[model samples]
Target: MSNDNHITIYEHEILRIDRGEKRVSVNQLKALQEFYGESGVPYYSLIHNGVKFCEYVGVLQVGDTLIEILPKVDKNLTDSEASWRKVLIDMLHAVGLFNLQAPSSSNLKLNSNSILDLYFELFVKEVKYLLRQGLVKKYRKTEGNSTSLKGSLKFGKHISQNLVHQERFYIQHTVYDTTHELHAILYKVLKLLLRINTNQSIQGSLKSLELEFPEMPDLKITEATFNRLHLNRKTQGYHNAIEIARMLLLNYHPDVSKGSNHILALMFDMNLLWEQFVYVSLRKFKKGNTTITAQNTRNFWKTSKGSKSRMKPDIVLNIDKADCVVIDTKWKNIKNYNPSPEDLRQMFAYMKYYKAKKVALIYPGTDFSNSSGFYYDHDKYGAHEIGKEECSVISLPYNTDIRQWQKQIALDIYNWVEVNDESSVDC
Candidate 1:
């Protein structure tokens, strides 16, 4: 089906709208429904003051405009209709979408005889009601003293208490300052529209190249082209994903719930960026005499039989000459000032079991304020005495993408291997 012939359905009916050059076509109706047919109790409407307004309908249009009375609601019970329209109008005005223009003489003439005449009439009635409310303040100020009156701004500054101020009266009726609120809301909407447009443009470009120039060589980004990609600024996905990850990582807050345990598990499991870094970094260690194995070695040794003491580090890079250097990737940093005894003992046990001298804990750099590497020497049984200089703790910043980090990790491992070949492998 042609995308153009869509009908917008609202409240299970087609809301005929003014589409300017576009017809009140079924396609437009469908598009309208998909875009703005939000279902809920109406919150604002045009009413002729307190009188039950039974006529007039509201239809939302593209670009933050609405056509009232153009496609009116045909049948309506009085009380419900009045309340619905009231909410609809108020909401539109609140959101700065209502920009009603005075009807021209010809328009009024047509409106008078039209089937939706009552809708127009009801709209005017509500406008008049507002006008009455506006006038009430104007006259009340003229008669009453302004000192004690708190309703309007004039009263706020006055010595006498009788008059209310116009400014305050206006403020009371508004959801937000219309001018400033419109500027922010419109800017936000435009930004979102631009992002979606960019995505569509990129897809279209790729399709065109495939169809018209299939044999052409693939597009390669040169230094000049590299500048065009603009990878510096954070993308929408980055911000959203990071925020979600941060919340889950800090699940220590009692009020911050992650829904079901299964959902929380999945949420943490989606730490793609963190996982990428860990795996790529491990690749480097494998290139030099050491082979890195995943899920083959336990992170922690089982202290007691039947006790689930095995710890599976994301990836373990074994040094071909000696024990393995263990590393773990964590999205969140260990916030406690001191590492838990269990964790320290686990790393120690890992060093003993794997018979590796070096160990490192990798955490996302964004989560930590400080970066420092340390060495621990426990010579209680001459353990550290035997290899006092071999065991070290390294803290590396997690920045660049996985590929870049992987290369760096490989270089670091190669350097370590070169320096170690001349020294004793065991303590």
Candidate 2:
């Protein structure tokens, strides 16, 4: 079994394998290379001697080692990996990935090495919560031979299969029990953690779950399975657990050939996460008749062959259902206090197409400031006057108290919008 050794690094940082440092074995490196090749190297870059981590922030377990790639948004992040890990966890909680309701953050040991243990603890708690509330029983169709006749019987199947066994009957019956897909997935996850989870604290809980959870048939999980799952008020509590299960089961890849170096990579696309985080914060803290939405799309160009190209801004704020404040989120640092030329052009295009006077680009930074400016009207002659349309390079400062930071996003946007366009709605 792989030990709980961890290699912690930030985005865009390189970790070289050597005896002087926490290094991977030859087989482990091969496994990493294999994963990189299979996943198209999106998470990290494979170099000759080491790997370069990228914008994807999460834990990747190779062999027994956990490579924790954390998000480094703040320029002044003087703290160690522990601080950033906590920040990532907090952001996840804020975005409703995992609820921080149970076993509060205060109770968790900040010194614990890998981020995986924290997630394991959360999953354990969620299952325990379900057990306490009592496992929900669902009606599942079971087809088999039984002595006692129940539901509708398949006469043909019974005659063919139960020919020698005169007392047996092959029939399709409906069973109302807790051995359903939801419990099955939870059981499967518990089984997984029981094998790979290194947290001594949760080992007993894992064993308990194994005993408590019903033995469910191995389910073939797919996106459609989750899509078809409709949670009523009674099953609403299972949402968090199901969500976590979706992440785990989907990302898991078992080593069938070797049966040892099974992989479980739970990485988040930092750009998407940042975009959703901002979008969720805006939605949560928005006050008034104003509305905020993400991925408000419009098809900009359609070819002669009817190939359509679409333009979708990350976020858009519509006021009184009148005007739009198109906002594009960049999960990057604006170190130069200047927006990229391509980005500025993108914002300009959005402004013209959306027919809005104001659009903004939001970036993560240490200081809250706006590099405000206007787009210049152009003619054949280069010299021109300022146009009425405007774009601002806005910075969202990082706060350890993520809730407060989220509220501040709305306030900042409200202040920015209302200050420029007085006709816009109030906060």
Candidate 3:
């Protein structure tokens, strides 16, 4: 209920506290229940009067109303107060949230002095970008009584209202509309963020944005609407900003009755986030004639006479029209640079099915020595006489410098694939 008790946590991180230490109030419990009912997953579990909070990873948001947990700050906290700003930008960019054409500048730092400051910064930036290019407009259908019959006549309404003899005609007009659904979403995000962010500067920026754009009733942005969004040359500049705005709106769970203070905080799942980041980076830096597929699951193997399971690898690399590599990213820290038995078996199955000569298991962390990479001979690893296939474990440290990390990953991928270039194995 208070800022002192609120703790910031990262995705997949658990928080447990005893009743005597910090008990969940009845109102907060109700809010949690409502959240679970809507999301079908409990944000926090209760055990014997103690609270075990589970924060979902992916995007960042505030969950102050339902729980006392906040987003975890970087372990190595800095005095500059802008340490996490670059990381946030890189994460957003990896997920295709930023326009590639937009100019990159370090001046675009976040005001992350507080829990929701980063979010506020992104919100303001998006609003300013949209304004610079102007808001998108479309023609919406309008219906009412008018002197001119511009569209189809509503004969039933005219007769029922006893205005048939009058000069007024029930008609419809397709007027050019400026208050499009996208603008409505933008307006909603600004309004919600403004309410939670106590920073006066952010609040003032939001107010200016609101005045520039027409006000519309808050609308829910669903997957359907997101898919339906289209862009042409005129509206292309707003594409990235619109996507960021949509993500902001999707994570927002606003309370209709209580207003902005009761809005559910935004958070992103770290596992999925890491996977996506890898996929995006690989695709972005892929070499010529190399095609990478994320979560490719078209192929399947029959388990029984009537049952079969799909083989959906995290990433499938097709080089020069051949299935060359099967790479799976692991977010966990590998102990002693040794992958678990289960992971080995999974990789083996993938190698056999894809007929890939090389399989790389990518992990996070930089402490491991890069000089001696983990490699296993297929015969020694229970491959029998199925020729010599190689499986290696590579460490990809999560660096705040996104460009450098991506470049290293791209180079690593190229080297791994080229290792088997001499063999000429066809799939």
**The candidate that achieves the highest TM-score relative to the unseen native structure:** 2
lDDT string, candidate 3, 1-427, tens digits: 2233243344334433333434445555555455556456545554443335553433223334323233222334342323344555566567865444354212455434443555566667766776766667898988888877788888888676645558888776788867777777777777776665555666787788778867887787687877898888877766655766776666667656564335445554545656787888888787888888888775566756878778878988883245568888876666454777787678778877887767777776654323223234545667434345566676765566788777777777677677643332211
lDDT of 3: 0.61
Q: Write down the worst ten-residue block by lDDT for model 1.
A: 259-268
Q: Can you write out model 1's per-residue Cα lDDT over 1-427, one digit (the tens) per residue?
A: 0123221221222233343332344433333333323561231222222111112233322222222322112223233433333433432322222223322111222222211222233333332332333311111122333223344444343434423443223211222222321122222322222322212323343343224321322232233432333222322212222222223222211112332111111011213334444564555345635677654455453455656556555556764336567654444444434444565555666556666656544543322222223334556654444434343323343322334445555565445534443333232
CA error at residue 161 for candidate 1, angstroms:
91
Better of 1 and 2 by TM-score: 2
Question: Considering lDDT, which of the candidate structures 1 and 2 is the better prediction for this target?
Answer: 2
State residue 28's C-alpha deviation in candidate 2, in Å: 2.2
Clashes of each: 39, 0, 10
**Which residue pairs does candidate 2 place in steric collision?**
none
User: 346 in model 1: Cα distance from truth in Å?
Assistant: 2.0
Residue pairs with clashing backbones, model 3? 7-70, 8-70, 9-70, 57-268, 57-269, 58-268, 58-269, 59-268, 61-266, 62-265
Cα RMSD for candidates in order: 29.4, 4.4, 5.7
lDDT of 1 at 229: 31
Over the full model, what C-alpha lDDT does candidate 1 score relative to the true structure?
0.34
